[model samples]
Target: MTEIETRVLRPDAAGIAEAARLLGAGALVSFPTETVYGLGGDARDSVAVARIFDAKGRPHFNPLIVHVPDLDAARRFADISGPVEALAKHFWPGPLTLVAPLAEGHGLSPLVTAGLDTVALRVPAHPAAQDVLRVFDGPVAAPSANPSGRISPTTAAHVLAGLAGKVDAVLDAGPCPVGLESTIVGGTPLALLRPGGLAQEDIERVVGPLKTAGDTITAPGQLASHYAPNAAIRLNANAAHPGEVLLGFGPMQSDLNLSVTGDLIEAAAHLFDHLHTLDAMDRPIAVAPIPNCGLGRAINDRLRRAAAPRT
Candidate 1:
């Protein structure tokens, strides 16, 4: 395959318009969202959606999230039920995704859904994302802008590091604020598919208690081993082993600190960037124990998956 020159576009009016034109013409574009950078393509175009999976080496069975400008646009592609509507009203423009039954006659490519009957939908809070979606006026199927289960990219530099010559363009809008993927809520009996930037307790407060999904890969981030770095990762370590780089949280002396103040929110924003840093050091990575509370739960979830023995 011939290499595509990836343009680094600013998140401005002209940049948004050009990015939208690329998507409309079935080219892959990586753009920033509140959670993480997403490798996006026109969801309605099977060929374009196929490029996304091919570029990332993503599995066909692992579905992609369709990001729209607003809830109304989301309803055009997904059968948003009452519960999903309630959740959207509260969290549409943030780090939350709702998987609902695919609406009848929805024109999304089967590749985007991975042949599943449900469609994952999100309205990202990032200004660049909103601008791209609005100008494109269609659903863009996006997954973390990395080589499929690798560390999610939180900045344009990270996206280019993994996919610079692989994708068409990347809209640089600075570092992602959330720095984690969106929390995915789906399935009957209402279970949490993935823990992410949005806390599980907050979701439970909005809806009732949510059953955690079992080992089934019903949504993104369900794979037992994902979000990995090149270096081996050791979780919940008090200190780094010899020749290992230490990633610490909450006032711990280490090679790099997620947050010196022990703030989970702050730690969440720094997670992937720190992982990228440690991975580049070409040393084994050790992480100080993070408390399993609020955003820490999501942080630990990513760490555990990152530390899981790669297949």
Candidate 2:
């Protein structure tokens, strides 16, 4: 990829127009999704999709989630099973990616699927994202808009700070409400490939029990040591260890609190933003224990990966 000036486009008509134009030309554009900002490329363009991997330094074998405008659009790429369709019907236009066998003549670059027989598809609900996808009128292969295995970007500044010059532009639309990635569910008899912004309980209510994925990297966010910061991480801490910056939950004195009221949703929203802040301080991070319930499960999932030994 050539070193280009990464523009920060506003989330307006002109901005959305530019984003679509760039994407159509097979250029990488970082745009807002409800979960986190995504580095988007034309899913059908092999060169563009390859640039995404180069920009993020992401592994070639780890597939990306193809974001589309609607279920009809998603169906054009991947087969939708009864359970997958149920989840999509319940969670589409929101933070959920359904992985299924690739449809015949899907027309996607093989890079999007990492040479697998399946593909991951998502329909985001963010208005700005909808505008871009609708205007672009095509599937976008997007992964979280930060360097691979690093903290996901919740704001445009984070994107610029991490991916500036590597990508073409960022459609800045402020912070993401859901600060985690979408839950990836797929395989025969639907399995939860990754825990993310959407809660497991909610998905179960919609599609019954979901089988858990094994060690294999079947989808995005399944990487063993992803969503991490450069600094060392310590999870489930009651208090900050000496020389460690504490990321607090439920308001005890600390460097920063995910939510003083102990609300998991609030904590989930603030997770990456807070981690970005502390990681900038050049110190280790100690995170307070978040309950294994609802969004906390996603929060803890990310924290555990952050604390995992770096390969």
Candidate 3:
């Protein structure tokens, strides 16, 4: 494992140049995307893409999502048809990932797609990420910057905690704004591959209703025992359980309630960070069930996946 060095990028020439150089050299760099801190590398380089998998111990079968500068860049990676174009036009530069069939002549390495016929791509809305992308001439393939099946990183420190000695550099762009993964929609009739910062209703509003895939997954962010903390997260409600570290929504911190006052968005932002904290304490954890709507749906999905049986 290589020690990962993180630099707070100055808003000047030197910082951007350094970042571009590291990325161009096939080194892994963690950067802020609107959705979360993504462990990024040149999308066209299979060696760099494979390093992302090796560093995180990610399974080869779970595909990575490519982060592009804009819709035009995305077109170079995947074949965007009418509906896909429409959705990108309206909701892109935000937290939406479209899984379109990879163009036969696409330039992105097959490893980024996990040898699949399709690829997941997004153009983030974060200004910091946009600046970084603009400085670089190519798209980047990045997954959540954490170890495979563990909690994803929303802050640069979180990336350091998990991958400090495993990667080359981390561009400290600060905390992620949306603080979750992008919603992945794929295939005919357009199914939800992963619930994320973007809500289902919002996607449906622009692209029509989406067919939802099952909880089990074969790609990034889809594992049953994923997004887990070292501490056991038991899914309970406001109801208390003995010897359990409980997470409550706004004001509900009976024993670390995650915003016990019931602000779903707050809970969403704090979810992984809190889990990592508690897991560090090595205590047993229980999470109160939240309403399965809007961000709640993404929240609950993460909790369910976290509690999935770990072999």
User: Which ten contiguous residues of candidate 2 have the minimum total lDDT?
Assistant: 215-224
TM match of model 2 to true structure: 0.99
lDDT of 2 by residue, 1-311 (tens): 56899999999999999999999999999999999999999999999999999999999999999999999998899888688888999889899989989999999999999999999999999999999999999999999999999999999999999999999999999999988899888988788898888999999998789998888887988878999999999988999888999999996998999999999999999999999999999999999999999988889889999899986
Q: TM-score for every candidate vs. truth?
A: 0.99, 0.99, 0.94
Error of 3 at 99 (Å): 0.2
| Alpha-carbon shift of residue 280 in model 2 (angstroms) | 0.8
- Quick one: best lDDT, which candidate? 2
- Poorest stretch of ten by lDDT in candidate 1: 215-224
How many pairs of residues collide in each model?
0, 0, 14
Off by over 4 Å in 2: none
Model 3 ranges off by over 4 Å: 1-13, 214-219
lDDT of each: 0.93, 0.93, 0.82
Evaluated against the true structure, the overall lDDT of model 2 is: 0.93
